[model samples]
Target: MIIFRPPKYDAIDHEKNLKESDGLKFATEIYKGQRSLSAIVEFVLSRIKNYVKKLHNFDQINKYIQGRTKTNKSKILLLTDKNKPTPLIKSIAIDYLSSFETAYITIKKNEKDEIFDFFKIDKDIAKLPQIIIIDTKDNPNEKEEIIVYDGDLNKVALSHYLSNFATPLEGPASKRMDLLNKHKNINNSQNNKKDKNKKKKNSKNTANAHDEL
Candidate 1:
């Protein structure tokens, strides 16, 4: 889920914000955020592409869905502060519909929307650099879990949070191996130092005994 405030005619600040977060992956903004809605759609597509690259089981999840005779796609929800659908917004919506199973909501100024209530978000959250709510349901019996992230887009935080739901195939094993190797090296170094100290002490004791004799 992605929620953002609509940029004004001069969207330089927004563009800069996106750039800072690496969110402008494939967006072509001729003049800052002055690009057409098509460009915005392209930017979103790029985000999805980046997501797939980072997510280990994204393809596997799609395959599972396909095997179950279901459409294999992500459910993306885009919320924007736009009262009317401009040409760019409309085109962006169309692109989203075609690419992913997407739903969008246009929020009017000062209009009370139910989505905010559902997400338990307020004006403060909307004012942030970005807001995304991730919902995961890993088991049939387990209650749905929601993770909310506000402020700038943090890929590391997002990855770590999502790992609680589904871990990467090799991530745990590689981490364990690294820890084991570190400990093994530390132990070997300590033992070598201890052996050297023991030999030095024995030699010193023998010298003292010979002198006394």
Candidate 2:
């Protein structure tokens, strides 16, 4: 499981600040193996960002991610600290990520805690932001690694760490999304037909009035 906890953004009341926080610049300069993180994570993040650009409703956002996790049998989770103020992207781009986590939960068959099975460590109450990748495949406590990614949420650690563990699956969440989109399309078609009929009726009424004149 990959966890991205954002820092406490104090003064960013506006949404425009997120554009400047792309940490991928460093990720590009840094390479591992034959693959650049920008090529892997950047493309993936961009697709998610683009797909969710117009999405505002959490339910809709949740539905969109139900199927994609099946490719790797990986599940995503979002834990928002209501105590802290998050950046605007938390409601937008990161919230797109929040959708994947949401869909993972709602569409999941079993109600289980399969992520973040780490050791209990007592530390400072001064909470700094962290990107914690907890691998619960063998045992949760032994396989967890954490990097304190303070200052901003845009970090490169999670993309590399995500593909390690195999997650539990209950049923296909994609089915729920399929049905929802099916109904939505049917409704849209019906609405469009009604609109055309209404327009034609208005046109006929105008013609009758002109004949009378």
Candidate 3:
């Protein structure tokens, strides 16, 4: 039996405030994608072409989604024609997709035949150029949900001029998470203070709570 390695997901430091945690920098971004199979295939193929055009060289492959998928559990597949990325770019793209050790596979046009055959994906479907992203499911099944995106290129130029500044709350996911974690810290601090004689007892609790943090 073949046992695939589990995903190496980054753990959030809930003990610290949002400002010092990984969520502030990396876990913030919108899903900005399509769920339909056909739509995603076309979307990714077009974006891959555009990503190469938008980025003429290997120096900077920067994008929002590239930064976003680094945290949390992410399973992504990058399917493209072997000829599209000129081999080197293809490898670079794969490296970029592997940000923060994301689980992914680059299914080239030629290799899809053998790979898809095992997974039982359609031949014609395999021939198309696109990416398949699986978020919640452990196995890559066609019947399962496939969430896909090519990153948000909306403010590529504007963000550059603005020194890469954006909203602190990226999307609903991060907003809710930040709020929840923020409140959790407050509650824990308050509870710890109750065990002491004065309200200023939080200093020691900070160290106590910070122990295994």
Residue 149 displacement in candidate 3 (angstroms): 9.7
> Whole-model Cα lDDT per candidate?
0.41, 0.35, 0.39
What is candidate 1's local distance difference test score?
0.41
Over 4 Å off, model 3: 1-74, 82-104, 108-110, 137-213
Ranking by TM-score: 1, 2, 3
How high is each candidate's TM-score? 0.31, 0.27, 0.26
lDDT of 2 by residue, 1-213 (tens): 132333432122324336545542322222233367656664444333221123223454334333333222223333333232233223322422322222111212121122222212233342322332222233332432332223344422333233233211211123444577789999999999999999999999999999999
Report the lDDT of model 2 for residue 150: 32
Which prediction has the highest TM-score against the true structure? 1
Per-residue accuracy of model 3 over 1-213 as CA lDDT, tens digit each: 112222222233323443454444332223356668876555544433111222222122222123332233333344454434433233233233322122233454456676556445677744534443444333434233444443442223211221211122222223455688799999999987776645456777778889969
By lDDT rank, best first, the candidates go 1, 3, 2
Every model: Cα RMSD to truth: 16.0, 19.8, 20.7
Cα RMSD of predicted structure 3: 20.7
Model 1 regions more than 4 Å off: 1-112, 128-130, 168-213
Q: List the residue pairs that clash in candidate 3.
A: none
